[model samples]
Structure formats: structure tokens, C-alpha cells
Target: MKKLIETIVKPLVDHPDDVRIGVEERQGRLVCSLSVHPEDMGKVIGKQGRVASAIRTVVNSAEGAGRKRVRVDIMD
Candidate 1:
């Protein structure tokens, strides 16, 4: 899951090396935290948050992720 998020986000950021994703299980839910260089935040978020929303949708649709609650958080 971590790799999946990283792969998806990295390409959208100016600083691919700065893209980071942390996964933690909380109350039976999978929480993914994504961090990128400040300058790339807008690129990751896109217009009207469409990019972020799409990212979350893709993550949530992944195999096992569909059966569990997966949350994606884009952090600065």
C-alpha cells in the first residue's frame, strides 16, 4: 500500500525524491500519509482537489484495500 501511494504521487511532484508515504494501522483501518516538497503540493492536489480525490479513490480500490477502510492524507 505504501509503495502504491508513493508510485502514484511521485510522478506528480516536482521533487520525486521528496515524496514520502507512511502507512499505519489504526482501529482496523489503514491510514496512508503522503508528504511531498512544499512546492509540489499544488501539483499533487490539482484543481479543486481532483488529484487528491483521485489518488484516494485509486488507493481505496486496490485489492485488499477494498475490504478495509483506507484513508489517504496529503501532508505538507
Candidate 2:
């Protein structure tokens, strides 16, 4: 799960090396915390948050994610 988020976000950032993802499962929910270089935040988020939404959609719908509720948080 962590790898998946990293793969999706790393390419979209100017500082690929600065991208980091932390995963935790709590109360049957999978939470992913994504941290990227400050300058690359806008690119990962996209206009009107569409890119962030898309990223969440893809992660939640992935087969490996199973039936768990997934939440992806983009951190500053």
C-alpha cells in the first residue's frame, strides 16, 4: 500500500527523493500519509484537487487494497 502511493506520487513531484508515504490500519481503515517537497505540493494536488481525488480513487479501488476503506492524506 505504501509502495502504491509512492509510485503514483513520486513521478508527479519535482523532488522525487523527498516523497514519502506512511501507512497504518486502524479500525478497519487504511490510512496513507503522503509527504512531498513543499514546492511539489501543487503539482500533486492539481487544479481544484482533481489529481488528489484521482489518486484517492485509484488507491481505494485497487485489488490489493481489498475491501478496506482507504484514505490518502497529502501532507505539507
Candidate 3:
């Protein structure tokens, strides 16, 4: 799951090396937090949060067959 998000996002940012992904299990839900370099934040989020929304959608779909709820948080 982490790799899928990274593969989708890393190429779109200027600071690929700065991309960080952390997964935490909370209350049976899976929270995926993605942090990127300040300069690349805008690209990851896109205009009006479209990029962020897309990322979350993919993550949720990838959770297939698992009951855990998936979330994506783009951190500065």
C-alpha cells in the first residue's frame, strides 16, 4: 500500500527523496500519512485538492477485501 502511493506520487514532485509515507492503525482503521518537501506540497495536493482526493480514492480501492477504512493525509 505504501509503495503504491509512493509510486503514484514520487514522480510528480521535485523532491522525490523527501517523500515520506507512514501507516498507522487506529481503532481498526488504517491511516496513511504522506509528507513531502515544502516545495513539492502544491503538486501533491493539486488545485482545489483534486490531487489529494484522487490519491485517497486509490488508497481506498487498494484496501480491497479488507474491512479497514483507509485514509490519506497530505502533510506539509
Candidate 4:
């Protein structure tokens, strides 16, 4: 799941090496937090958050991901 989100977000930003993702399990939920270089925040988030929304949708629909609640957080 971490890799999946990385693959989707890396190319959208100027600092691919700065993109980081952390996964944690809490209360039966899978939480994925994404952090990128400050300048790349807009690219990762996209206009009006459409890019972020799409990434969350894909992660949530993954085979095991859908079984539990999957959340994607784009962090500053």
C-alpha cells in the first residue's frame, strides 16, 4: 500500500526523493500518511484536491485495502 501511493505521487512532484509515506494500523483502520517537499505540495494535492481524492480512491479500492477503511493524508 505504501508503494502504491508512492508510485502514484512521485511523478507528480518536483522532489520525488522527498516523497514519503507512512502506514499505521489503528482501530481496524489502515492509515496512510503522505508527506512531500513543501514546494511539491500543490502538485501532490492538485487543483481543488482532485489528485488527492483520486489517490485515496485507488488505495481504498485495493484488494485488502477495501476490507478495512483506508485513508490517505497528504501532509505538509
Give the winner by TM-score.
Answer: 3
Model 1, stretches more than 4 Å misplaced? 64-66
Q: What is the TM-score of each candidate against the true structure?
A: 0.92, 0.91, 0.94, 0.92
lDDT of 3 by residue, 9-62 (tens): 999999999999999998889888999999999999999999999999888988
Off by over 4 Å in 2: 63-66
Which digits, one per residue and each the tens of the lDDT, describe model 1 over residues 1-76? 8988888988777899999888899998989889899999999999999999999989888836347789999987
Tens-digit lDDT string for candidate 4 (1-76) = 9999988998898899999899999898888989999999998888999999999888887836338888888887
- CA-lDDT, candidates in order: 0.88, 0.89, 0.91, 0.88
Candidate numbers sorted by lDDT from highest down: 3, 2, 1, 4
Instruction: Tell me how far the alpha carbon of residue 70 in candidate 3 is from the true structure, in angstroms, after superposition.
Output: 0.6
Clash count for candidate 3 is 0
Identify the superior model by lDDT, candidate 1 or candidate 2: 2
Consecutive 10-residue window with the lowest summed lDDT within model 4: 59-68
Cα error, residue 34 of model 3, in Å, equals 0.4
Error of 1 at 63 (Å): 3.8
Give lDDT for model 2. 0.89
